[model samples]
Target: MISALAHGYGEEAINIFNNMVRSSMKPYRITLVVVLNACSHSGLVQEGVRYFESMTRDHGIVRNQEHYACLIDLMGRAGCFDRLIKQLEKMPCELDGRLWNAILGVCRIHGNIELGRKAAEQLMELEPQSSAAYVLLSSIYAALVFKKKKKKKYICCSWKVGMGREGETTYGGDWRDR
Candidate 1:
C-alpha cells in the first residue's frame, strides 16, 4: 500500500487499505502515515483528516512525529493555514526539522514572509547545518519582492497620432510574478 502511494496511485492505495481492514488486519502508525501521505498527494484533505482522527480515536494508534508531520503537510497543502497552525500548536512532540520544513514549504507557496521567517528560525535551531531552511526563507523573501515589483509597469509607447498613440504596457520582470 505504501509503495502504491509512493508511486502516485492514491486510489489503489486506499483500496488496499480498505481491504486490509476487511481482512481483520490492524493498521500501525506507519500505515496511517502512508495513507495520509497518499491523501496529501491526491489532494484529499477531508479523507486525510478522517484518517488522522481515526489513528487516535478509532485505532488507538499513537501519533509519532512522522504522523503529525503528515497531518501538517496535508493541511498545509490544502491551504488550511489556520487549522495547520492550530494543530502545530497542539502537537505533543517537539517541532522537528520535518515539520518545520513542511511549514516553510507551505509558507513559500502562500508567499507568507512572516510565518516563513519564523519557521526558518525554528528549523535553523533544530538543524543548523542544513541549508534547506535558509533557501526556503530566501525564496519567500524573493517572492515578496517579486510581488511588489509586479505592480510597477513598464510602458512602451510608439508615436502614432492616427491610431491614438499605439502603446503596449507590460510587467517587465520575471513572468512568474505576473
Candidate 2:
C-alpha cells in the first residue's frame, strides 16, 4: 500500500486496503493516515470522505489529528473550501499546527487570501519558531500581487535574531500599505 501511494497509484493503494479488509486484517491508525493521504494526493475526495467517515463505525479506529489533517488536505486540494470550512468547525479534535498547515496549503493553492491569513496566523501561534508558516503566507501575498498586476514592491524576511531558540523574527507587510 505504501509503495502504491509512493508511486502515485492511489487506486492501487485503495485496492490493497480493500484486500486487507477482505482478508480480515484490521488496519492500524497509521494505516488510515496513509490511505487518506493517498486519497488526497490522487484527488479521490469522495473515497477519502467515505473512508474517514467509516473509520470508527466500521473499523473501530477512532479518528485523530492526523486523520483530520488528511481529510482537510483532501477537501482543500479539491477546492471545496465551503465544505472544508464546515468540516473544520465540526472537527472533534483540537486544531493544531498540522491542521492549520493543511488549510494554509489549500488556501495557497486556491488563492484564498482571507482564509490563508487566518490559517497562517493560527500556525504562527501554534509554532512560532517555525518559518514554514511565514514563508507560505508570503507566497500567498506574492500570488495576490501578481494576480493584480501590482507594481508595488513586497518584502519578506524570516530569521532568528537572538541567542534564544525561541527568538524567531519575521517581517512582512502588504504592498498596498506601501
Candidate 3:
C-alpha cells in the first residue's frame, strides 16, 4: 500500500486497503496511517476525514499522532486552513515536531505565511538544530515575496542567494546563533 502511494498510485493504495478490510484483515495503526496518507495524496479530503473519525469508531483502531499528522497534511495540502485549525484544536495529544513539520510543509505549498510562521516556530522550538523548519519557512517567505514583488528573491536566514561571492556565505547561515 505504501509502495502504491510512493509511486503516486494513491487510489490503488486505497483500493488495496479496502480489499484487505473486505477480506477481514484487521488493520493495524500503521495500516490506517498509510490509508489516510493515500487519501491525502489523492486529494480525498472527505474520505480521509471519514477514515480518521472511523479509526476508533468503526475499526477499533485508536488514532495516534501519526493519524493526526496525516489528517493535518491532508487538510494542509487541500488548503483547508480553517478546518485544519479546528482539527488541531481538538487534537488529543500535544502537537510535536513531526506534526508541526507537516503543517509547515503544507503552509509552504499553500504560501500561508501566518500559519507557516506558527508551524515553523513550533518546529524550531521542538527541534532547534534541525534545518527543515528554517528551509521550509524560507521557501514560504520567498514564495510570498515573489508573489508580491513579481520577481525572484531569496529569503533565507538574513541574506539573499547570489548576493555574495563564493566562500563568502551568501546565505544568512544558521538560526541557532541568533
Candidate 4:
C-alpha cells in the first residue's frame, strides 16, 4: 500500500490501508515508513504530518532518522523550508550525511543559496570525501554563474560511461550535420 502511494496511487493505497485496518491487521514500522514516504511524494503535507504524529501517539512507533528524512523531504517539496529546518534541528538522533544532502538538494532547487551553502558545509564536515557534496557545490556555483550570464538559454551537460569493445553509442545531432 505504501509503495503504491509513493508511486502515485494514494487513493488506492488509502483504500487498501483502510481495508487492512478494518481487518484488524496492525501496521509495522516499515508500513509506517512507506506510508509516510508516499505522503511526502504526493505532497500531502497535512496528511503526512497527521500520520507522523499517529506513528507515536497511536502506533507507539518511535520516529527514526529515516522517518524524519521522509518528513523533511515532504516539507521541502511543499516549500516549507523553515519547518523542515526546524524539524532537522529538533531531530533526537544524530543525522547522517544523506539527510543533510537531501536538504541541500531541496535548497538548491528552491534557489536558497545561503541555506544550500550551509547544508553543504555541514555535509562536508560530516563526510568530507563525499563526491555528491562536491558535485552539488559545483552545481550551485554553476547556477550562480548562469544567473550572471543571463543568456536566456539552457545548457545541458551529458556524458556516458561504459566498457565495450564491439559497439559505441553516439548522441547529439545527426553525424551528417557534423
- Top candidate by TM-score: 3
Q: For residues 1-178, write the lDDT of model 4, one tens digit per residue.
A: 4575666876566567667767988888888778877777777889888888888887788988788777877788788988987888788888788788888877776767888888888999999878777788777777676667663333334565657434435444311211
Candidate 2: worst-modelled 10 consecutive residues by lDDT: 169-178
Output the better candidate (1/3) by lDDT.
3
* lDDT for position 167 in model 1: 48
Using lDDT as the measure, what is the rank order of every candidate, best first? 2, 3, 1, 4
TM-score of each: 0.78, 0.81, 0.81, 0.75
lDDT of 1: 0.83
**TM-score for model 3?**
0.81
Instruction: Evaluate all candidate structures by whole-model CA lDDT and list the values in order.
Output: 0.83, 0.88, 0.85, 0.76
Worst 10 residues of 4 by lDDT: 169-178
Q: Candidate 2 local accuracy as lDDT?
A: 0.88
- Which has the greatest lDDT? 2
Give RMSD to native, each candidate: 8.8, 10.1, 9.0, 6.5
Clashing pairs in 1: none
lDDT of 3 by residue, 70-127 (tens): 9999999999999999999989999998899999999999999999999999999999
Spell out the clash pairs found in candidate 3. none
Q: Give the per-residue lDDT digits (tens) of candidate 1, residues 2-87.
A: 65664488778888887898898999878888899899888889988998888888788988889888888888878899999899
Where is the poorest 10-residue window by lDDT in model 1? 169-178
So what's the TM-score on candidate 2?
0.81
Give per-candidate clash totals. 0, 0, 0, 0
lDDT by residue for model 2 (1-178), tens: 4645634899989999989999999999999999998899899999999999999999999998999999999999999999999999899899999999999998888888899999999999999999988999899988787768755556666667556565535587555443
For candidate 1, the TM-score is: 0.78
